[model samples]
Target: MKKIMFNDKFSLTQAVLEGRKTMTRRIVTYPLKFRGVNVAGYFVCKRPSGEVTEICMYDEDERMIDGGQILPKYKVGEVVAIAQSYKDLGYDPDSLDRDPKDLGIRGFMKHSAGWNNKMFVSAAACKKHIRITGVKCERLQDISEAECLKEGIEEHLKGIQYGFPSNIGYIGQYPFSNPREAFSALIDKVSGKGMFASNPYVFVYEFKLID
Candidate 1:
C-alpha cells in the first residue's frame, strides 16, 4: 500500500503532465477511514492539456463503498473511464449536459492509509465545483449532508477538485480517523479555491488514522 500526501506544495500540475506524457494514471491513497472503512481511489490524467482527465471509483481494501469499483490502468491520450456521461444516459433533453465539475456542492479533502495529507473532491462536487465555485443551494436541495460529503470524496478521487494555487501556502491542519472525528473541523469552510487557506485566511489542520 502507498500513502499519498496532500498539502499546499503538492504538485498536481506536474503529476498531470507526467501522466499525460507517460500515458499512465496516478493512484493516490490516503490514510483516513470513512464509516469504519479504509478509503482508497485513483484519478486518470488526460494527455496534452493535462486537465484532471477523469476519475475512477472509490474502493476499499475490504469491499466497495458507495458503489465503488476497481479501475484498470490506462495510458495518457487514451480514453480514461473516470465516470459515465450523464448525457449519454439521456436524462433531461432540455437540461444542459453534465460535466465532471457539475456534480455537487461543497469541496472536501480525502485522506486514507495510503495517503497522509492529500485532498480529494467528490465526483458530484468535482462536476459542480468546476462549473462554479462556492455553494449552490438549488443544486444542494434534496441531498443530505452525508450525501454532500460523498460527492466531495468522489470528485477528489477523480482529480477534478482544485487545490491551492502555486502562490498559496498551508494555513491550518487537523487530525482524525473517520468523518465523524473530523466533522467539526471540516465543517468550518475555507474561503479559497483550494484546500490551503479559507477566505478569511485562517489555517485549518486535520490528521486521520493511517494504520
Candidate 2:
C-alpha cells in the first residue's frame, strides 16, 4: 500500500478520477551525472537510500553510451492509493459534533488545516487507487504530444471540452499553441519554477485508476 500525492487542489486528482490523466513524471531524487545513452542504451544512478535508478539519457544523439536498471520507488503492477484530504475521504474524527466544552487542544488539532492536507492522508484510508502499468526513464522535455493529453491538459485548437478548465496560459493564446507548450507550463508548476528549462531526466509512470 503506497500513497501518491496529487494535492494541487485536487485538479490533478480529479483528472485521475475522470480518466483524463494516465501518466505522471517525477524528477529523479538522485543526480544523473552522465549524459547520452550508454552503449547499452541507458545509464544508472543511485538514490541516497541505495536504490538504483536507470535513466534514458541523451541530448540529440541517441547513440548508446551507458545503462542499468532499478525501480526506486514504484514498480510495474504495483497498486497505489491517492493521498486525499481527510474531509474528502469522510474520515473526520471530530466531525464537528463533539460538545465544545469537551473538545480541548488535542481535539481541536484534529480539526486543524493539516487534516485536509494530502501528505497526512494514509493509503489504507484512501478510496481512490491506481495501478502502475508502465515505467520508464526519459528527459522531461522529450514528452510527446499524446503524452501531454494523458497528463490531463486538453487542447482547445479543436475546441474546448465541457466542464474542463479554460486553456489559458502565458505560453499561447486560447489553449496552448501545442501539446508540448502546454506540458511545459504544467511540469514547471508541478515539479518546480524552472523544471522545463532545466530539462532533467525523469521517471515516467503510466497508471490506470482502479477506484
Candidate 3:
C-alpha cells in the first residue's frame, strides 16, 4: 500500500471524515505519458497503420502495479493510506519537530497545530484507507458538475459565493452557482493560474473508504 497526503486547509480531510469525498483527481506530471483517450475500459490509440487498444490502467498481462513509487495511475483494490493529523498508537507527533522534550508545549506535540509542516505518520496512524474502485484519464476541464460533487463539493454559505464550506462551518468551496464552476475555481485555488486554462490531462480515481 501507499499513502497520499491531504491538507486540512481546503477541508479535504474534513470532507473525507464526513464521508462526503469518495473520489479524487491527481495531476499527471507527464514523465510517464500514454497516448489516446480512454473509452469504456480500454485506451484507444490511433496510429498510422491502425488502432491500438489496451485495458485502461493496466499492463498487457493485467497485473497491478505496486504503489510504492510514483506511477501513471493507481490500480483497483490497491490500498491507499490517507495521511492526516491525529493521535494514534505506534507514532509520536512530538517527535515531528527537532525537540523530543517539547511534549506538552503547544504547536509541538499537536500535529493539528502545524498544518503546513510535512508529516510522516505510521500506517497504523492513518485513520482512512481507500480502495480504488475505478480509474480513468481525461482532460481536467472534462469534469462535470456531478463529478465535482463527487469530489466533495459542499453546500453554500454566507460571504463565500461558492466553495466547500470552511472548516469553521462556512457554506461552500467557490463563488459559483453550480458545482462545475465551483470545481473550476477549486482547481485554480489549489493548482494556481494557467492550470485550469492549460486543461492538462488528469487521472481521476473513484474510490471508497475501506477503513
Candidate 4:
C-alpha cells in the first residue's frame, strides 16, 4: 500500500471527498530507455496495430521484475490515504489548521507556509482512503470524453442536475465547453503551458473511495 497527496487548489481532493472522482492521471517522469537502450533501460512495447503499450518485463528465470507493473503507485486491493485536512478528522471545518508538532505529520515545509509548519497532513490524519482498481498508460491527448468524466471534471462545472435551479451553469475556471476540454485545461494548469498538447505518457489510475 502507498499514500498519495493532492493539492487543494485543483479540487481533485475535494472531488474524492465528495465521492465524485474515481480516476486520476499522472505523467511518467522517468525515461523508459535502458542500457544500450533509449530512455531508462526499458524496452518499448507496442501493439501490432502500432499503438504503444506497456510490457511485462521478466528475467531469465521467467520471474518478473516490478511484478510487470508501472505507475499507479499502488496495486489492486491496496489501500491508499489522501493527504488533505478534513473535518471528520477532528479539525475545525472553518479553520482546518494543523499543528506542526503532530508526530504523524512527516511533510517538510517547502514554499507553502511557515518554514517550520507541515505543508500537508500526515497519512494517519487523513480522513479519506481509496483502493486502486486498475492502472494503465496512454497519451495525454487521447483521453476520451468518457474518461474525462471519469476524472470528475464535471464536478467542477455547474449544471441543472447539480441542484442549480437557475438553468445557468458555471464553467469559470477553464471555461471549456466539454469535460475533455476542461480536463485538458486542468492538466495544462497543473503541469505547465502546452503540456496536454505535447501528449506526454501518462499513468491512469482507476480507484474507488473506501473511507
Top candidate on TM-score is 2
**lDDT (CA) per prediction:** 0.26, 0.66, 0.58, 0.61
Stretches of candidate 4 off by over 4 Å are: 31-43, 46-71, 86-89, 92-120, 155-172
Candidate 1 local lDDT, 1-211, one digit each (tens): 1112221232322222223111111223233565786555623222222322222234534343434422222222232222222332233434433233333322221111111211222233112111111211111123343432332211122122224333322111233333332322333332223222221111111112111
Error of 4 at 35 (Å): 7.4
Model 4, residue 97: what's the lDDT? 48
Clashing residue pair totals per candidate (backbone < 3 A): 57, 9, 10, 6
The C-alpha RMSD in Å for every predicted model, in order, reads: 20.1, 8.6, 9.8, 7.7
Error of 3 at 172 (Å): 4.7
Error of 1 at 52 (Å): 28
Worst 10 residues of 2 by lDDT: 165-174
TM-score, one value per model? 0.16, 0.68, 0.62, 0.64
| Leading candidate by lDDT | 2
Over 14-57, each residue of candidate 3 has an lDDT whose tens digit, in order, gives 67757788778877652233344332332222112112112223
Model 3 gets an lDDT of 0.58
Tens digits of per-residue lDDT, candidate 4, 1-211, equal: 3467654577777778788778888876653443444432443332222222354444444544444444445566678887654433445433424445444333532322322222345566566789888776777887888888777676343455546554433241454556777787888887888999999777778889987
The runs of at least 3 residues in candidate 2 whose Cα sits more than 4 Å from the true structure, single-residue gaps closed, are 31-70, 92-114, 157-174
